[model samples]
Target: FNPKLRELILAGKTQTLSPKENELLKMLAEHKNDLLPRERALKKIWGSDTYFNGRSMDVYIAKLRKYLKEDSNIEIVNIHGNGFRLVAP
Candidate 1:
């Protein structure tokens, strides 16, 4: 979690993250392997749990997954109707 530069260092490569992505990543990292509920994450980062905001968050999750793919042990798992869990092995 490189908040200062909005980047993620993985597999010896530096991948930059958007402001929103950084915030989301930071939140997920804080929880690490725990489950972060959809409503909880939405309200924290997006300030609401509206339908559109939910959709936007999903897109951000996809982006994070792609960014961390180079590292086999790092993964963002969706908890179905819940939210996400960042698994760091």
Candidate 2:
């Protein structure tokens, strides 16, 4: 996690992320080993809890998962009907 550059370096490569993605990553990182409620994340990041926005968040989450997949110890688990938890070594 490069706080200054707001970037993530993995597998000896650097990835530049969009502002929304960065914010989402930050939120998950802040929550770390805790559960981040779906509605809460939606409201915080997209300013709404609409179904469309929820779907958008899911896309962003998928992107984050792809970015972090290089590390075997990192995972984003869905807590069906609830939220997500970011687990890291």
Candidate 3:
């Protein structure tokens, strides 16, 4: 792993995270304030877009939100029927 990535992982204070949670946070950090499409997350992380997978993604999203709650400027906003945006200010 790159030293910078290691530092970021350490700074996040994440000892361990589920696969979905780790991928979600990685994408969010990559996009930052940009929109992160739901379909993209589903396809990339879960590898499918079935109803069950969608629900699982929701669970992961909720978990990420909880983990990032300490940063007031960071938020995961749902763009009803569209996607989510990880806003950082």
State every prediction's TM-score relative to the real structure: 0.89, 0.87, 0.75
In order, what lDDT does every prediction score? 0.87, 0.83, 0.71
The per-prediction CA RMSD against the true structure, in angstroms, equals: 1.8, 2.1, 3.7
| Model 1 agreement with the true structure over 31-58: per-residue lDDT tens digits | 9999978788777777843545466788
TM-score ranking of the models: 1, 2, 3
Candidate 1: the clashing residue pairs are none
For model 2, the superposed segments whose C-alpha errors exceed 4 Å read 48-52
Ten-residue region with minimum lDDT total, candidate 3: 1-10
Query: Model 3: per-residue lDDT, tens digit, 1-89?
Result: 12234222333564456655777778877778888888888788778445554756788888778767766767899888878888887
lDDT score, residue 5, model 2? 78
Give the candidates in order of lDDT, highest first: 1, 2, 3
Off by over 4 Å in 3: 1-15, 49-52
Q: Count the clashes in each prediction.
A: 0, 0, 0
Error of model 1, residue 57, in angstroms: 1.0
Q: How close is candidate 2 to the true structure, as a TM-score?
A: 0.87
Best by lDDT: 1
Assess the local accuracy of residue 5 in candidate 1 as a C-alpha lDDT between 0 and 100: 90
Candidate 3: give the clashing pairs. Answer: none
